[model samples]
Target: MPRSIDRHELWFGSKLNPRRNSLNLIRLVLALAVLVHHCWPLMGLGGGPEFAGEWLGGWAVAGFFSISGYLITGSRLNNRLGDYLVHRVARIMPAFLTCLLFMVVVIAPLGYLAAKGTLSGYLSTTTTPLNYLFSNMFLKMQYADISGGPYGVPYPGAWNGSLWSLYYEFVCYLIIAALGLFALIRKSPWPITIAFVASVLVQANIEKVSVFLGQNYDFVLLMRLLPFFLGGSVLFLWRHRVGLHWIPGILAILSSLIIMSAFPGWGGPACGALVAYALLWISSWLPSPEFVHRNDISYGVYIYAFPVQQLLAVYGLHHFGLAAYMTLSAGITIGLALASWFFVEQPIMKRVRKGKSDSGAPRNESKSSLPEETNGIEKQGSITATTQVN
Candidate 1:
């Protein structure tokens, strides 16, 4: 006699013991949260979150950083800086540049006003082809202050509001890169982490003392976030050391609710750190529900959300409730997500990143050996991917 198995449920709960499978899902969720924060203004909704000097916008941005903290540091902590950079650039920039181009030529020309009552006026400072190309390559100038860098004609005059977060995100990359260079020198996370932690502490405290000392830049904002960013490093440094994640996991859940509940703008960096730890705990236990992960139309939704919401609001189509907005936005976004995933994201990344062999077999994968955890790929003979991060 044979017993029937609930294969789907068994597959779903294969990791009832918890695993890192959920990292991608976390990223997708954070991206969507950012979209919601941007959409709040378009929908003309007004209800402050309960605690602290925070808002949904702040939490959303922080979530992005937290995820970055995990992925960038987690991947590079054990690898060569060059390899890490190559892989990260391959993963992040191709699609990002694609959207940037579309934004510059298509969205900027039409122009939509912002929550602050500005028209993204004179946006050519970073929105032009030359500027975007140069910045995207050499400057990483997606979100720099126009005054801080080169600006004017044929540059960004109009850009997405999300550009601000992108700037910080890139900075985090550079910080990790610099650390990677030093990794060869030091060969340990202890010294780098100590210095980083100190830097953040100093950054976090400067403002409190500045009132008596004069208006100096408060370094605390940075100090507050470094600890969380370091959390990722900790995960990598001791990936095999995890035994009891539920404690940190529960703290992650509670802190997330609290941080989001409270509208602390700068606090996002710190709270996001807490959320980072939370992510470590939950990465495997709750990989984005299969439908979301397999479908993963999030990137499309994120790119298209602002413009669509703006156009809709400008034309007074925002009378719809939040649920309806999410529904419609999801549908519209899915179309683009599918298109980009199938067309732009998949094809270009595949072609450019893949090296050709004389026999027409792929050689790029050999050049860039993937960590077991991140190899979301399966080939003909070798089966390398595992359910955990290396």
Candidate 2:
């Protein structure tokens, strides 16, 4: 007598274990894509590079949010609010604060003095202190002020333009935590699902909302990015039922592209959902080598990239050529990012984890736990697909 295996079981069993996937590399690539996209504008090319202009950077950032959505939703589901906050802080703050300080004390001071030709003038600019305080707080306290840099730089006033996304990322985290806490109390996904649908719809209609409200810059950006974040959450909530097959994944992406081309703003949510599905599909079905998991420098890379680009612009490297500027900036950026991982971020995170263990707090499942559907089929030791989204 032969036993019949559940079709879903066979399907997932044939796929790579989620825990062992190369999400770190995926994030790193996305981050680099953003850096490369910026090269077009930063290099004085007169306009955005074909294919890498506004479209690529925004898409990469959206992809980052999608990954964050899935992993952060998983984080909220499996851990206590306090523990989750602790983990999020450990992942984000140390590297972020360090980068912010570098921008304030080193980059800003140097750029200001170089451009303005007087320390007193640089010191008198209130924007300097404001940038430090507000930007470090994720812009909740103050808006970023980019007051100094070489005049020739493409974006002289903006120190770390890439940082704006961090504020949104933090907001998304809060949103997920709020919904997750409510779901815990209610023991239902309906509320969260409804919120997700509403958010997506709002995003789809963002252009109309912008026009009706006279196009507030912050409002428009938030609406544009929110759909992808919500899509990620939806994928997490419905992970068990979502088709992981490549055929469906491909079709969804193509369909979204067609709809987006046809309907632009109205198709926003559909595009976001398809993007999230494609990202998750790649992460789940394709595993990376064990060695690739050892170091996660994506956060460092992301935080450090803009400063490097700005520095390049100050030095007139942008006049050289796009390839030369990108290569030089990326090289230095990667070096700093690796150093941040090895010296700053990794050590702080390790200490934070140890402190939590020493305090004897009830531990959540490892951040990498497999989804509910795969439980018991694989060894309990297998890692979950969710990686560090930040």
Candidate 3:
């Protein structure tokens, strides 16, 4: 097996989290998956007719949601309602704005030049320079005038098609936060969690029935994402309670998968219920040394990838062949990832977090020191948790 480590304890949602290395690793892998998906077309080799590979790669987005769910759910619950907004803004905006500026200043101009037949094929352009600039400059909620919602791929020639996922992700954050706020008011978590599952089903139904359903899917998969976030809180509360024997946990995981497969289309509750336990197994069973905790580079990959592959395709590297294209693309992407980690992510996040720590002791307190309490979440951060985004 590929070397596995357990950093679930260190993820962003945890109260005393230094960092979320395991989830970051997962994010990094998902970013690579994004790169490959985009790169494949540029390489001129289709993803091929393999169900598992397609499913796996397509599922990477699901993994992204899962990780976000894990981190944010605990974050929403643990923080002071008022301060949650500030933390969310600080955590998201700096990196997001940085990346957005980069796209407009650097990538869009490159796009423009290519569009006007001035620059060579590190990209190909079927759209006008204005459209190219528009897509890269503003995160369009509806691409090319189609109601594919914001999440679906827009007119391909426009820059940064992948950003559409951010739209859904942000939307997911709102749903969770609102649900979370209601939970706080009612003094209960289960109601909102239950509502979330119902919401996903409603979403799927609206899709099947109404042609107006712009975005729809079995978002029940998203519930699993929440576990990563909530599990961190759970770990903080009950780490001593967890034991490291994997057999029962593994069986439970197997059972969940079996249920998912058998139903293929049913209640999302089963998935939601297992999320906490599934992540628990990841944290306890794995060895600590293997769980290399560190600075995050994954966010950079997430922001930069679409433009990278699209640029490569414009270069006509596909004319050379898939293998050569992938190699070159990976090399370029790695360099970008390293640069993003060093310059954009690490410096900014560190500074913001430090500023918060320096501003006197945290006033917002939780019954326990889980994510809900540690950062002193303000209301603004809660609503705009994922909104001040890249």
**Best candidate according to TM-score:** 2
> What tens-digit string does per-residue lDDT give for candidate 3 at 227-298?
333333333223223332355457657776675566443322334434444543454323333322343566
Model 2 sits at a Cα RMSD from the real structure of: 5.3
Off by over 4 Å in 2: 1-19, 46-54, 116-120, 129-131, 134-136, 141-147, 184-187, 207-216, 287-291, 365-390
Determine the backbone clash count of candidate 3: 29
On residues 298-318, what C-alpha lDDT tens digit does candidate 1 reach at each position?
A: 555566665555544544455
Each candidate structure's TM-score, on Cα atoms with residue i matched to residue i, is 0.67, 0.83, 0.67
lDDT of each: 0.49, 0.66, 0.47
* Ten contiguous residues minimizing lDDT sum, candidate 3: 381-390
**Poorly placed runs, candidate 3 (over 4 Å):** 1-21, 42-44, 47-54, 111-116, 119-156, 183-187, 208-245, 263-280, 283-292, 361-390
Q: In model 1, which range of ten residues has the least summed lDDT?
A: 381-390
Report the alpha-carbon TM-score of model 1 versus the true structure: 0.67
